[model samples]
Every structure is written in structure tokens, then in C-alpha cells.
Target: MKARAGGPDHRPPLISEHDRDAAVHRLQEAYAEGRLSHEELDESLHQVLTAKTHSDLASFPEENESTIAAVSGRIRRRGVWRVPRILKVESALGRVHLDLSRAVIEHPVVDIEVHLGTGNARITVPRDAIVDVEDLRTGWKDPLYKTRRRSRPGGPMIRISGTMGLGRLKIRHARR
Candidate 1:
């Protein structure tokens, strides 16, 4: 096990119960959404159940081009990454961080779906963009994460929704 910086030697994250449940839950969600066939779900579920490391879920990102980060494991999308029209992010036992402060937004309205289990998600946006998370969580976790809309004419807008089981959703303003 590799040690975290200034932290104790870490056991493989795959051994965590949250990771195990997250993997299965993600596959079930995909199956329910008609994104996975019966055979695929069965195969994927078997793989996840028997996975030795978190890397075993690499096949998930290949499922779609609209995904900004890893589908099953820890996901972090930062810097100048491209922003798609609609983004779906899922993490079971890990964290999901999307830094859209410098991302290129080609759409006036962007939709983001978040599903997490015992894991947290954070989205950072620039001052110019509008954020609306009211349909999701209560806005007290982070000062920047408000449900109110703040748009400037044709400025971009992001709509975030979905579930966070035993986790939190936070939004922060990026440094200008």
C-alpha cells in the first residue's frame, strides 16, 4: 500500500466497503437507464465484485464521451478541460471534483448529473457563470453553493441534479 503524502500507508481503496457498493450501484444505475444490457451488467457486476484494485473499472469511462471524469473510481476534472453539453458523474467510494472555472462552455445551458455513495462531489465555477443547485441539496455546506441564479444575458448556466448517498455536494467560486 502506498502512503498518502504526510499520511499513513494507505490500504488499497478497492478493499473499502464504499468502493464495493459504489461499483455495483453505478452498474445498476446504468442498467436501469438502459445504458447497459443484461449481459453487460452481469459481466460488469462480476468484474466489479471480483476486482482486485480500483483500476479494474477503467472500462467505465469508455462508455460515453460526455463523461468528464472516471465513472467508478475517484474522478477529478480540472484545468482547461472541455465541457460537454451534458455531463454525468458517478463515484462510489471516491471523490468527484470538477473544476469548470477555466473550461470552455459551448452551450448556453449545461446539465450535470451527479451520483455518489459515501463520497463527495465538488464543482468550481468562474464568477461569470450562473449556478443553480436548489433542485439538489440545501445550500449551506459551502458559501458559494447557492440555489439562486446569477446570469448575465447569454452567459452559461449549469444545472446539477442527482443523488448523494451519505455524501455532500459542494460548489465553490474559483479564484479570478
Candidate 2:
């Protein structure tokens, strides 16, 4: 059955973190190309950040993301998977592991938003990547991360954020 525009299945497209980031990047590029003035770029950036649906992003570029979620058991993402600019992982009562050391990373900055209810999360980052967990919040324990070597000048910056209800988050740089 073909539904009307305002029908249940015709709901607007939901906005994701990657969408907003892509829009901001496009707006910046437009400003750099002299298509948008400074004030216009600022206004567009504000609008992009606050966008909630596809219509709100009408004037900007579009991009998608990936999500890994589970209710129980274990969740793992390793191997040579393609990494998106924004990746979200959620689990209710399971362990989560993400290995980005050998994954295909195409962006300069990667955002991993994890929302775990009751399990630990382990992330293996690239050898030359830089990590920042300053915005991560935890209800039980702090995240464990150690820098064994200095980050390269143009290496990827992995920014991990989100809330953990009751578990540890361990991060380690991959070996060469």
C-alpha cells in the first residue's frame, strides 16, 4: 500500500551525528570556495548542528553512519571493515570489542559513541592514531587508556564518547 506523506511509514529521516558533521564540513567548504559568507557559514553551521531531520539538512551535504547494537552476549567488530566517520555502539548486557588497527579508515577524525548498559568495552586503535576520552562518562569505573608512542602528525584522531552504566572501557594502540 502506498502511504501518504504524513502517514506512519512516511516519517521524516532521522538525523545522525555523522550527518551533522558532514553538513558542517560542506558548509565550511562552501565558505572556503566563496559561495557562502562568513556570517552565512556560521548560521548554517548552527542550523546543521541543531538539525533533527532530513528537511533540516536541505541545504547541506548528506552522509550516513554505522551502528553496532546488541541486547545480550558479545558484540565484536574487527577485521578489515570500513569505518565510517561516526560509529555508534550500544549494548544492554554484553561485552563489546572494536578493533580499528586493520580497518579501513577514510577520515581524519573518527567518532565512536558507545552506550553500554552492563558490560566492558575494548577498543584497539591504530598505532599512529590519537585518542581522546575526555567527554566519556561512566557510572562505575573510569576508562583505561595508555599512550605507548607519540601520535603521528596527520594520523587519525579517534574520539570516543558516551555513557557506560556499569563496565570498564579499555583502549590500547595496535602494535606495528
Candidate 3:
């Protein structure tokens, strides 16, 4: 059954971390150029990260709450796999991939811990889910590339955190 016009879209159009990150990046640049205040930057970043639709993001905008573990080898997950509530992945000298485009999600929030040691880790998420990367500690240069996806108010959330040492962390959206 179709809902009424102007009403809430039960399943809002999906947004990706990449889209959100780009928006945030722009705001950051603006702040750096003295177009915005520190407070504005923080508030804008929050708005961008929480934006529901692209339009929501456009207005001054923009947009897991886990577990898997991988260590010392190349690990990949994809294609109809089951994503546990808590997944942790640790690579002492290898690679880890946590792809959720085709995975089974049975929770409103998922938590993931990605710890790398002289290795690499890549996380691929669905456009519909949000990607939250916070408190990532790294003493050495651990390059991290990601597409920021925000969790809808009541939708699925993916929380990611960890430490990377001489490793690279990449988080992006899967190709549709």
C-alpha cells in the first residue's frame, strides 16, 4: 500500500558515508576559510552526519550503533553473510574485509572493532546503513579512507572503532 503524500517515507532514500563525508569536508573548508565558526563547524558536522535525505543534507548541509575479528591473514566477508551484533577484526599482518551490502542484518545496531598491526582493513557498508568511526587511536600513520553513512533515527547503525599501526583502514559504500 502506498502512503499519503508529504507523509513520512517509511524507508527513506539511502545515503552513504562518502556523500556525508564530502559534505562535511566542504563545511570544514568553509570553517578553515573563516566562513564559519568552530561552533558552526561542529554543529554542521553533526547535521551532516545525521541528515536523512540528500535534501536534508543540502540545507546548510547536510548527514551503528558490531562484531567480527580477523588476525594475521586476509579475511573477506560478503554475499549473504550474517553480520553479528558484535564483530571484531584484528590483523597483525594481514587484511580484513567486512562487506555488508549483501550481508544479513538482524539488529538495529551493530558494533565492530577493527584493530590492525602492520596490516590493513577495509569496511564496505550498504548505502542504507550508517557508518560511525570514532575514537580511532593511532600512534603511527594509519591511513583511513571512508565514505560516511549516517544511521537513520530508528534505522540500523554500524559503530566502528580501533587502532591502526602501520596499517590502512578504508570504509566505503558498495557499488550498486
Top-scoring candidate (lDDT): 2
Clash pairs, candidate 2, are none
**Candidate 1 wrong stretches, greater than 4 Å:** 1-65, 68-72, 137-144, 147-153
Point out where model 2 deviates above 4 Å.
1-26, 29-61
Instruction: Judge candidate 2 against the unseen true structure and give its global Cα lDDT, from 0 to 1.
Output: 0.85
Write model 2 residue lDDT over 64-140, tens digit each, in one string: 36898899999998999998878999999999999999999876678899999999999999999999999899999
How many clashing pairs in candidate 3? Answer: 29
Selected candidate, larger lDDT, 1 vs 2: 2
The residue pairs found clashing in candidate 1 are none
C-alpha lDDT of all candidate models, in order: 0.70, 0.85, 0.70
- Which runs in model 3 stand beyond 4 Å of their true positions? 1-71, 142-155
* Better candidate number, 2 or 3, judged by TM-score: 2
| TM-score of each candidate structure, all chains considered together | 0.54, 0.68, 0.54
Query: By the lDDT metric, which is better: model 2 or model 3?
Result: 2
